[model samples]
Target: MTDPLVSLPAFREAAAERLGAFAHTTVPDSPGSRRAGVVLCVVEHEGVPSVILIKRAYRGRNAGQWGLPGGRMDEGETPEEAALRELREELGLAVGPAEVLGRLDDFPAASGFSITPVVAAPSDPGPLRPSPDEVHSVHHVSLARLAADDTPRWVPQIDGGHLLQMRLRPDWVVHAPTGAMLWQFREVVLLGREARVADFLQPDWTRN
Candidate 1:
């Protein structure tokens, strides 16, 4: 049988526990001309919780893959500010400062960026206008759906040169981008289970 869904407050407390103990590591591509921040907006609909995911336009790296709404952080801006800005620019959603939940662990990319994910609650909900130049589509997936039995399966990379490793499961996979946060959200917030980066292997594509 599947586990019961925990309350939102319960989830937050659990997430804090895991994030507090996470360590920071230097990314492979350290020095870069630019940096970015992303938002992993988690929302609830009629008591069922879901996460906001977006498909980037088929351009640049990791295109057409599912990810959170975010992009490069502008100069002289905090990660939180960058996250909020990205949401408005990409999704045309205006979220108030009060809606921000908290910040998650920073995950660096092989593309020379250290991304900080800011978790927030949407002030209003409805149809969203996605920036055609950057976003292809948006999906609101429930946590329960993510935890469902038929969720997408992630195949771990076998090559040794990869920096991030992951394992496929019903709800989510572990890698960079939203991987670490997803793991933390599940282990700490959802199941109250303890997990570490070493607990799972990195996917091969992250190394490239």
Candidate 2:
């Protein structure tokens, strides 16, 4: 028997209803900002709701970090379109626009990029093949793990706002903006908490 809380029907219903009800907050205007798109791809694996993440290739500014599969938006492309395209290019998963559930809060990276995270629930993500040039590995994180009350920790920040850090694996931990986004998804979509995490601070190492 599947866990009712992490079952596909409940995930879809909760995700759709909560995401549909909330109005997404966009990135604030900033000089020299570039637009980027990221996909919060959700799927059912072994009868549990899970989210996909990628360990970035050890090259870019955010090299070797676990984040969503996505990149900069192409010319004349919407955030939704870019998310789908990146998922295909990075993970070889082609999810159509119809599967897109909604958008989470826009995250502004310290790397001069304004990122929009698109939420989508694709039934089958196909055989995920990670692009060596972009992704080092892929992670399928179960929602049950994310919903645990002890999952996220409050780490003190220089600015007095506590930074959020969540464990993805025994040895792997992720922080905002990926951590913030994931926390928000768990709060609003999974538990319907109306929780907010954008104001959370990023670690000094990621503030490039």
Candidate 3:
């Protein structure tokens, strides 16, 4: 059967309910470091749902990885504020406070930032211009594509294994740099399921 219509509020509520179960207690305390925020913008087109993803420029840290629109949270700026700021800075889109549905559990990066994914809806559909300073391109992939049974696989990285090793599709794969909030957004909010980071397998770029 086709999935029921998933509204922003419904998704947010589901995320909030699931947050308590997945919430992290102790964040890493490092010198000169601070909390960060991210925005997961979900937009609907012609009754079909999709999400906005950004391809970071292959120059700086985590270059060429697929991720959402987000960056570091400035002092005194709330997660919601940081999300809006990042969206405007990266995509030149103005998303207001009301558009935010709610927040999901903060995903800690191995690189050190405690990233929070803020879920929001756009006021209207319009042209999106990618800022060359940060983004390489912006594209919308259908939720249906991600939810499909066809799993993504890659070759396992080894010193001298067979040239072709089958790697299982990760439950989530938010590319580096962009810090794309992939897995949790898909399983928890969209699919209403829970997944572990270990469930995902990173691709071997050398094989590609």
Q: Candidate 2: how large is its RMSD?
A: 2.0
Over 4 Å off, model 2? 1-4, 28-30
Per-residue lDDT for 89-194 in model 2, tens only? 9999989998898998888777667889988888766988889999988888898888888788888867677778898677878898888888998888777887
Q: What is the TM-score of each candidate against the true structure?
A: 0.70, 0.93, 0.70
CA-lDDT, candidates in order: 0.61, 0.84, 0.61
Determine which window of 10 residues in candidate 2 has minimal summed lDDT. Answer: 1-10
lDDT of 2: 0.84
Weakest 10 consecutive residues of candidate 3 by summed lDDT: 160-169
Candidate number that wins on TM-score, 1 or 2: 2
